[model samples]
Target: MSIKLDYKPVVVLTDYMYDSIQPFQDVYDRAGFEFRPYQCKTAEEIIQVAKDADAVQVHFAKITKEIIDALPKCRLIVRSAVGMDNIDVAAATAAGIPVANVPDYGIEDVSTHAILLMLAITKKFNILTRTVQEGMWDYAVTKPVHRIQNRVFGLMGCGAIARCAAKKAQAFGMRVIAYDPYLKQDQVNDLDIILKSAKEVAQESDVVSVHLPLTSETKEIIDREFFGWMKPGAFLINTARGGVIQERDLLQALQTGQIAGAGLDVLSQEYIEKDDPLLQMNNVIITPHAAWYSEEAEFTLLTSAAEEVVRGLNGEPLKHPFNKIPYAKQL
Candidate 1:
């Protein structure tokens, strides 16, 4: 039942920031596809290098409409990460190109990281650790820490990662409430997560964790208005995209005591200047967008992305499609 094509398909990596493309190479080589990789940062570079690619793999490069229109032979686009914000999905849809992403690769790693942030902030680990190392062991510096038992844990989104977080939060004796427009109340009843409005979740929870993807609707969604709805002295955790929370408003919330503290794995900006005030705040914990890291997660992410490319070339079903395209065009 082996079918062979007369010509070898060309697969291009628009840009990959990782140290090695060995995973992609192995998949493409086994499939008898030509692998062309370029470290492109802009649409112009991608167009010049990969105009005739049959399938494209992207990492950090911005895939614009112009580049999509130029790729006359491209039928598939696979983002190497969970988020497809860099790719112009709408344009790809119009052109009948199927776009895909590796969404579930780091679910456990990211959800676990969110819970870690929650525990660290609740216990005031940052200030306590620093004070003791600075030759001061006064528990009074970070006093008033509250027990997490019986507290309300709210999730802004209830996707796979959020659902995982909900179970973990429940295990901590915290009541889990969530707001997800796409899910029904009964859908989450098995996990004991109460469905509520976003504003209700914000007001009721002692700790609000963000788990939504970054999109036009979600960009800067957690602004002053959302903060105003939150209970004073409540903690905020964002292991999702940085743009979901407005940085300036978050700073004001912290300054005015609207919220007690924040644990952010992602920021509005990836690399902040040393002078940025968020760095100086004792109540805030920031990680370098590394919530999706672990040896196992990295391997899954890389191999899953390559598997998608294989599916695209062999006309097999894509497991994680981001855009809808006719099956005929996908071939």
Candidate 2:
């Protein structure tokens, strides 16, 4: 009986990832786990595909309450990205499954993306490119560009990515200031960035960048009032969650010229509709939420998520567990 009692974990991927799992298959097998990939897009599909899974890794699949309730054997959910907004975290918590994310996997990539957006907006990269393509090379048309040096680069949240962004901004000769209630004064001091309230940061910055997580309190934090405080002609960049800034307010602000331009990597909706107003605005630079991607980052993200599943199945602590729950039953 003792010899026969062995744990064989079933680690199911909620959706396909770019990184192949073949390389890590042997590692999982050695640890008494099996890795299986699925292309489940709906709740019912997820329930059918992962009902018997001991652990699951998610990329873009929405793990709803129905799927959570149906998975009787699932003990862990590891999101490939930092944001777990796509997954129903509350439902998973209630069901006693710990949710983990690869929070540090793409810090450099995301920070670089933030800087890229900032430079594009300041230099009018898109419109200038379009002008040249239209057989016009009027450099004066892109005149009136203010130097980034000596300009303020304001940040909303000072997490790992934000810290790197601050360092990069400073290297470009921009002054950095941040608004993050969670960080202590000493932490901000160590970064050599002035710590201020959100309103103050918005008012003083020449280029304001958002780098916060999406939570109930943070959703729509950058509404009309917050936008109203921003310095006129200042550009805005959001490498953070899209819901952090309200789209309606942002649209109004842009229409009124409250801000000079905007660069968004995420939107309230990931897929920008064909008729969206932002699409018509020549000042906005929008990317399809690809801030957290690089060959190395994707590999790290995929492997890290798989490792979390192994840890959860073996009753070990997860590296980047986001939620708090009492001792969960292990596989």
Candidate 3:
């Protein structure tokens, strides 16, 4: 007797991630599966599209419990990036839908972006670039830049991105230190990075780069007390999650020169209102959460995430499953 395989449709609920994953169309086609792309602008629309999907390819789209409940046919929910806060992992788990993410997809891109922010702030590139563009050559001569070499760089999280940042900082002739409770001392020593307390890392480093994931514990991790612990002219670079740093406290720190400057690629809100204080600051550089967005990174993210989907469909074990929530243990 011959057995028939059940091929289900994989719906992609995203904005523009379809374009990124276009290269993998052949892979999906060869697998004898239907690939449906839907641009879901709201949570409701996501639920509607995901209702009949066997697997979902998600990006920044919010996957709430409502959507999870609606996706009765969905056995897998794959995120294109590492962070799964946008998805209701507990609900997915309860629904028996495995959720995966591409954790190591943009390691170099993210690390490079963090370092770029650090270098830009330390060298005052933003000011210099604007001054030169405005034909203010005299200001450049008067306001000289600082060298990155011999400076201390601190990482708030010692994950893969942080480790990559440490390696890059060393290449630029800077000393690297990091603060992470989860990382072992031997691991830190192996990377040749100084392991210090969070307070010490903040106080001593010439430039502090935040690489921690956003969590209940890490939300507003860099608040007033954090700014107070930093060196007077120290710079800050946040290419990590937005809520990791408190915007109000950061604004006050910049206004009072508590910190020298900041290069931020992410914000607590993706689209801040017009009157937001961060918009009024001249010393701060803000990008629209594009630190992880590079041509190379996008390609890697799309290809890797697509591969994960294929793996899940083939009943193979996933390489980057995010449905396992350690924080859930507390509840």
Backbone clash pairs for candidate 1 read none
- Which runs in model 2 stand beyond 4 Å of their true positions? 1-5, 17-30, 325-328
Pitting candidate 1 against candidate 3, the one with the higher lDDT is 1
Q: Which prediction has more favorable TM-score, 1 or 3?
A: 1
User: Which is the better candidate, 1 or 2, if ranked by lDDT?
Assistant: 1
Lowest summed lDDT over 10 consecutive residues: which window, candidate 2? Answer: 1-10
List, residue by residue over 129-232, the lDDT tens digit for candidate 1: 99999999798998899989999999999999999998898899999999899999999889899999999999999999999999999999999999999999
In candidate 3, residue 88 scores what lDDT? 82
Per-residue lDDT of candidate 3, residues 258-287 (tens digit): 998899999887787888777676677777
Q: What's the lDDT of the predicted structure labeled candidate 1?
A: 0.89
**Best prediction by lDDT:** 1
TM-score order of candidates, top first: 1, 2, 3
lDDT of 2: 0.86
